[model samples]
Target: MHDLIVSPFLDGFLAVRPGSPACVRLPTDLYEEVRAGADNTVPAWLVQTAADAWSLDLDGKAARSALLVREPTELAFARASWEINLYCNFGCKHCYLGERPLAGLSWDDKVKLIDIFRDSGVLWLQITGGEPTVDPDFEGAYRYAYRQGMMLTVSTNASRLWKPDLLRLFRDCPPYRVVVSMYGATEESFDELTQRKGAWKNFRKLMAAARNAALPLRVSIVVTDDNAHEVDAMKAVVQGWGLDHHVYTNMQPTFSGEGDPLLVQSTEFLRKRPVFEGCNAGVTFFHADPHAKVSICKIGRDDQIDLMTEGIDGLRRLGEISDRLMLRTGGCTGCSLSGSCRVCRPLAKVYQEAKAPLGMYCQHGDTKEMVHP
Candidate 1:
């Protein structure tokens, strides 16, 4: 397996180490030189540069086939998020995927989907789920994507992280990051929030194992009404474990426009988001559901492109779709606060459809002036 991945990133090329965050930008001429080098060998200067960046000695004459993998396309995407399956072990109240259906593409089809992702220029792929690790073909898919030179981020619940086979796989080919969601601080609150008995115990055991193995891990502190009081305790727990964490208090309506999740929102913990800025979703990134249906992003699922049928060419239409979906329409039509709106148009539409309070997503709401508690 190659330790370095040379891939087209946006308008340029990047040489990055698998399982590491370090990257080096290669100029057009250097990229062409590497691609056209004799016997697919890495140049001496690049070897020394990579050694300096990673603090590891490398063979100057290493065959490119042995030391690196290059992406085959210039029209590559910078990032993508894929929901391998919607199936999840935990039934949390604040989950945006409300239905929690047990469904996804078969192994053969999944392989095809990954190929499309690779061919379409996906460099950084986030494998998520209703809990991605629980998928039956997750290991196969993960190994395949890693081999394809795509840096991966697994968004999991940490329930299955302790499995010996999984630990070995991660040790052999580490993901760029494993994002685990922390439901609550205490076992009682944790299990109650997920509505799954023994979940807290399983999570604790797996987290310890993962830490012992030195796997790259980050924590997302999910704050809801049930665990609102334990927010501080949650932070302390993560800190004690020596893991980086981010607090997430805002709860969105379900993909189908249901407001059930909004009921669990902890108003006290809600933090104001930064000002709305333009995003590269669909232009530089995209989201894919289990069945290989591509959308602008997780939040905007309209006009999905069927990658399984239409193939990668289907993505060409997303640029147009992104523009249309971002228009200030429906409830937001003619809104005076459009310039300073925090939520994007598609997300705002979902909130409006669910009849969510303006205070939750709108700057013009009565609670817009709320301060962090």
Candidate 2:
């Protein structure tokens, strides 16, 4: 049978290009699918080889064996998300944390957690929060992690970063990424999501600060019904700023509060095109919340394994969970949600119907269903 090796470049559609009659790359080996339509697409051999290493398993393994060997690391990193806080000032219509950042760990607990992550060789730590910068000890925590040789990332609203000291801190030790969420191009659109009047101004200033620092930055805009038309305009603005970035559309609804009730689209008016396949949350990446909760995707934090206690083995155990949720869970087995689910996991606490899947959002002119549960 023909063998296919998946690579980081493959997302949403490319995966299914080889269609049901393709093969894929596994961690320790290759996975050759007798029927490739659902899992992947058959691209030109050169294209596939350039993105991934693959070969035809002419040794008759598929004929003799129904089971295939797979590796999790090929898709998932050891650690991707570092939950810094549960609290967020936005109290967005859809909030996954459910609660705000309540209490923080003691200094000892903080040190221990960082120590564990360091010991595990986790270099990229995504520092998120209801608002991570809001953490009373955010600077301290960031310094500690930096000192430990961990690269940092922050997902924030960009409102709290106006302080001169904070700006300097970012300039000196800027995160590998500072993913600022821009809800809209105008105040009306943005304020609706953030429910704050000055948010637009704050975000703009935040961008200015980053520009002044010449720090690396990525602007993440959540496309909803209201601002879907402005996706390209927004992207152009970021581009005009001369920053390296990608604008993405989330298929999942907001975790809490009023969700984005925007209609899904098939065409691309914005720079961000429709991602036919969903995220590979568990398969390609994983998250560890501030509470030490380990999940396949950041949105799957509600129902998750506490990695703080379970450790690396616990992450490995998640492979079974990911497969079960993606493969055996009825309609979701081969749905379009697979591509955008870069942050998806089976450990979510909420469950929606098959057609009305959890975290449903618009993509490619269709209402692409997503799962957070």
Candidate 3:
């Protein structure tokens, strides 16, 4: 049978189209007889491989098969997301944390955790937070991780980007990328969203600092109903500055079930049931909260496993949960949502308790379909 290995680095398996046919997972050692695909459009490393014949016999293999591989496969992770600190000075209207950063792993513990990711073969690391700069040891943590050979991505508000220490750090060791989230296009709208006056002026200064330092930068405008009218203006302003930018309309859900009324996308724009083959969340990507709980993905936080201990083995275990969830389940059994739920898992507690969509999960789109408890 013709097959192609989708991700050799993790959960190595054949790539198949949505509802293509039945497929099975195999051990790495059993993978044999690989030939490269001739198509230049495909990844050169994605080789075409064939499966071995079924052997029902007990004394199955030869001594030569045992020595084919000289060593056990190395643990490899392509990317990671770290919530370094959940504390932010600004009270964003759409923040998911919805709380002042009260507690988390200490600075030294954070450094050790960075080492763990490095040792486990994570090449790209994203350091995020309620705002990463809020952490006391932000500079130290940033420098330590970059020195370990990780290409880092930092998401911040630009509030602390120009601090003497951070500016020095950036000049010495530039990050792979920096993303600043602009809540609005003008001072009034920006101040309204962050509830902090003079924030837009600070944002402009941050841009000036970024330009002066020649740091790689990308800006994203969070388009909400409150600032929907400014979407085109924001895009034009950001592009006019000669830097890359994008816009997102989705709103974050707070753990307390207090979702923002003004940020939900319209039904016409709501994502409906679309065909998807599969996702690489726990398999290829992982998100760790400030407390060090590693979840399969951002939306699957409540059911996450602890990564404070067991380290790599703990991360590897996440794949099993992801694999199981990717299969059909009750209510989804033979239902249309089954094929479409490639990476989807259960939504937060409010949805389960209410049996309805919450926030962006609200495919029903309008307020009429969403019942407020």
Candidate 4:
């Protein structure tokens, strides 16, 4: 039998309420305490004793294990991201949000957003947009998220990041991390991808300044047919930074959609790569849009019930959404690749629009290989 594995989050609590099934292992003393509504504390010795009593597994090993179960909070790591707006200044060829530039968010709305996220009980918030910095009240919104104890991460072009005060603000009030998309490693390539001249210089200067400030940074590289050949080179560049990089395979062509046009690769190109066959949206993680609309993940967002209004309680309502509408249910059952399926809600949306075969719809082709490798 496969050994059991435990998640770190289970370290202290005997029970975890992740908006769904709670994992509980009853110990007589603990159960009594809980029944009495006592301020029960789980000590290390108690945990070891309980594990011994249950013979639980640890991390797929035969050692001690922590009680764990699939739940909404566990899904998506229980983190929350609010796509404040879709409008971005640079209308790149591969944007998923499909937001228009110059269409900024209102100040009153920004205040309300702070309250919404703060009240949601989610301690993580991401401010994204066409260009979040472009928001008229961008600083105010950011300060609000910070004041509320929500860790912040900004996905940006880094054009205005050169501003000293802004850099100081981020370095002093550092969030968990900031992710910047580097279209290309060089000037010509980057300019081509962003369709904005001088963008490369701006990125280079800002990244250097951020490095000086010791800001936590992550880089994402979008792989496409146009730049597929450069994957190896990009990997080298990412390695040079001594930081991990994320590479996304281009989404497949869509019949008609609001998303950017894709650089469709051939079937051979996809098959020659690694294979991932299962999806972990509702099971491992979930995605929510700007309005708190929930999707199993980005791939299925267009198809799931809105959770903002319904709250976490709405997941049960998926039972009524009909299997036919849930594409993965029909295509994924018992598939050998089920464990590694890369399909997510956003990718699923692309598939629905392109009607492309499942293999062709992922952001990066069917593999989790380190791009640099």
By TM-score, the best candidate is 1
What is candidate 1's lDDT per residue for 233-330, written digit by digit as tens?
99999999999999999999898878899999888888898878878889989999988999999999989999989988898898999999999887
RMSD of each: 3.2, 13.7, 11.9, 10.9
**Superior candidate under TM-score, 1 versus 2:** 1
Go through the candidates in order and give the clash count of each.
0, 58, 0, 22
- C-alpha TM-scores of all predictions: 0.95, 0.63, 0.73, 0.63
Please identify model 3 stretches exceeding 4 Å from their true place: 1-73, 261-276, 325-334, 341-343, 346-373
For this target, which candidate reaches the highest lDDT against the unseen true structure?
A: 1
lDDT of 2 by residue, 7-47 (tens): 22222111211112233333212233322423333334434
- lDDT, candidate 2, at 134: 82
- lDDT tens digits, residue span 185-256, model 4: 777777777788888888888878877777677788766555667777877876887666788665443324
How does residue 17 of candidate 2 score in lDDT?
14
Which model, 1 or 2, shows the larger lDDT?
1
What's the distance in Å from true for residue 309, model 3?
3.0
